[model samples]
Target: MNTATPWITGVRQICLAVEDCDATIRRYYDQVGIGPWAVWTPKLTNTKIRGKTQPYSLRVAMAWTGDFMWEVVQPLEGPSIFREFLDEHGEGVHHVLVETGTEDFDQVLAEATARGLPPIMEGSWEETDFAYLQSEHALKTNIEVLRRSPIFKGRPEPDYYYPFPPPQDSPE
Candidate 1:
């Protein structure tokens, strides 16, 4: 495997955009036996789209199925890439997340941006920083770059059900 990109270690998660969060989660559990998922509304403090700040919320459910993590995203409110995917493609795999080291985070981000894949969504939670690159045209799916501080150990245990915010009108 080409390891020119030293920052990127491997695939961390695969994200899907779904219309109904509950139904999708239930279906995955029944059909694929993937969950007991942990559902939560990601609180993105400083999100950007096309390099401009945009407010958005996503109702996301995550589960670890063997080696990789799987994520289901339901666009809850505001202008988001998940909403755009749902609008354009209905429902399908939206992105693939890659793990990067915190030490090389800036270089990785700079390289992605220089290659014309600007971030559509980016935020930092505790010690982890994540950015979703808008590379669907070239790569067929968005690329999410994640870098977590060494202090950040792992995700919380899966939760059965987490209350999500009510849906809101899409941004104009």
Candidate 2:
């Protein structure tokens, strides 16, 4: 007695990791050129992936583009997605996000699984309804011409790369 939910939305943003966040921002603000601040969250970084050289001081930048927003993420330290891109591509466009419309995120997740698109995170965001398809599966989606952008831009770009001096309290 299970029912499946349907889609009701599309991509809202595509995040990318850059080498020089300021430079990247200027390029868009000065080059591609868009507009006057819509809404942006403060720098919220501080996630590390151990055994990496993230610099622990990254930044995330975003701006409106046409009908969607272009987000740029600059990793501060360790070997984050940003660093991965810099090491290979040297900074640029990243992944495209398809906003979930169906409330039955679980249904969608199941669908993706059926399609061989297993997920990585499902704690809350990747629940039964809203989930991200592995990079390979995203490409195979065949929904559009280009394959899914890549896994680099799936997550939101943080404001800072790492936490400062550690929180006042640690698990005691």
Candidate 3:
């Protein structure tokens, strides 16, 4: 019950900053039977690092096992919070994506800034906007909030499905 950020309704995803996303995905599947990961590299637009426009890339893999989503991100190019996290902490839990009940990312961003936990990295892909706030000092892990578009339902096809596609995606 963090009163500072009432916009956050619940935890939706837990993201791990990994050195190698595919290797980590393979290892997770081999060890814990977590597979069918959807992998993609998003073309982030209007990306900003500390209020300055700076571009970066990541190989991101996501998998859902019931209601919770797991995300692994490998920093691909340029400067990013993910890269900094790896340099400072190695591979580990970097951030948790929280569900913001509002569809307006600007409102969420404003609330976070007013709370003194400004975003270190923020960007948008298509109809979704995401912000990674600098909250490690207070919360131990960075906090990420996203405003997902209502028009978009179901997963946008990943670049590839790891280990193999799910039964629903399997070819006849």
Candidate 4:
């Protein structure tokens, strides 16, 4: 953790924005043996970007590479941070996520907000609440703060899926 921000535990995950998630996963598996990959389409509700509520969906795959997890995100539908990264920078590393206790999640957000780094995206995934700080200007990529609920124990083995569920109503 940086001395400036002690709330952050450490770099938990590194996310890449990919145009083809399957191909990327396959390449990583065959070339680097990064699998087995857990692939799913995340259903993010009550989403917000720059403080305005937005609804979005993303096809994501996760695989463990030693201590840190690697994530590949393919934006499926709706406006999303992944789509924005792809549009602006094509396919590449999008963000570095840091883990924090659920108890300190709000405080981390408050500290970031106080420093004029408002979240570019904020939403919940399963039992985790995540916020992506718009830190590209200073850090060359976004910074994601994650707070995992007890239900989200740790990474599981690869499980592939198509569309997770029917789309929800778009944000107003």
Number of the top-ranking candidate, with TM-score as the measure: 3
- Per-residue lDDT of 130 in model 3: 85
State the RMSD for candidate 1.
Answer: 7.6
Instruction: Quote each prediction's TM-score.
Output: 0.82, 0.52, 0.90, 0.82
lDDT-wise, the better of 1 and 2 is 1
Q: In candidate 2, which residue ranges exceed 4 Å CA deviation?
A: 1-8, 37-58, 105-110, 120-132, 136-172
Model 3, span 70-144: residue lDDT tens: 899999999999999999999999999998774467877777887888999989887787889989988899999
lDDT (10s digit) by residue, model 1, range 24-96: 9888888877765778775667677777888888788876666678899999888988888989999999999
TM-score of 3: 0.90
What is the per-residue lDDT of model 4 for residues 145-164, given as tens digits with 9 covering 90 to 100? 97778788643333562223
lDDT, model 4, position 150: 72
User: Over the full model, what C-alpha lDDT does candidate 2 score relative to the true structure?
Assistant: 0.45
Q: Each prediction's Cα lDDT score?
A: 0.76, 0.45, 0.85, 0.77
* Superior by TM-score: candidate 3 or candidate 4: 3
Ranking by lDDT: 3, 4, 1, 2
Off by over 4 Å in 3: 1-6, 169-172
Using lDDT as the measure, which candidate wins? 3
